[model samples]
Target: MTVMAKPRPTGQPGYSETLPRAAESAAVARRLVRTALAAWGLEDQIDDAVVVITELVSNAVDHGRLTSIRVVVSRPTEDWVRLAVVDRSMAVPLMRTDTNDDRIRGRGLLLVDRLTERWGTDRYRWGKQVWADLRCESAR
Candidate 1:
């Protein structure tokens, strides 16, 4: 899906939203990324966090299509902001190291692993919650 950067007027600092994991989820994620950043007056930092969150939500839509996706944005005491995405998927995303093929679609987890400040998962009876923490310089 092609996503154009959205231009938004600056504003506040926190919001969390949940969206269903479906074919249109990418669009929802993109909108959320832009809205979250703009609402927090941190539109400038949207690229990194958006990119990361995009991948996370994309994975949810792609791998866990029948589940639900959740996103959270917080200033967390000012100095930085955190961007988190959670999905109801029982499959723990595993980073594949055996393949050297760049086109093979398993690179999402690796990319997420390298980009975020911190990332991990939480097990649930029906699924799991995958999350990442994003730090923004102007978040305060």
Candidate 2:
């Protein structure tokens, strides 16, 4: 992905960081999310946002093509913070309904579903971005 020296405006505060598509990159992604939320005064959403971003980054590292992925955090509204992972993959993340305790995988998106107000994928010419919106109750 091309790096932007300055972030484009989205009518609210936003930030993005490009990182290697590796497991360790999740830590950096978490810090990016936490920092953005803290700057926006949305600290209450930090824990859930971190979890959501970690899952998204994990999926990207496991399934996405290419060597790097981008993590984006944006406050589109006072009450909502958007966390997104962009990778060079067209694969849409499906939340498996057949997961059992015996199953070792396939429950990450389920956890994301439970924690976020809404989430989905945005496909672009180069790849896809999976994003989740966390609602801040205190912002209301």
lDDT of 2 by residue, 1-140 (tens): 99778854542557899999999999999999989988877778888889999999999999999999999998787677889999999888999888656888778999999999899999999899999988887755
- Candidate 2: Cα lDDT at 106: 73
Tell how far residue 90 is off in model 1, in angstroms: 1.7
lDDT for position 19 in model 1: 84
Cα-based TM-score, every candidate: 0.73, 0.88
For residue 78, give model 1's deviation from the true position in Å: 2.2
Off by over 4 Å in 2: 1-12
lDDT, candidate 1, 25-98, per-residue tens: 66677677788777666677778876777777777777774557787666664456566666666887777676
Query: Which residue pairs show collisions in model 2?
Result: none
User: Whole-model Cα lDDT per candidate?
Assistant: 0.70, 0.89
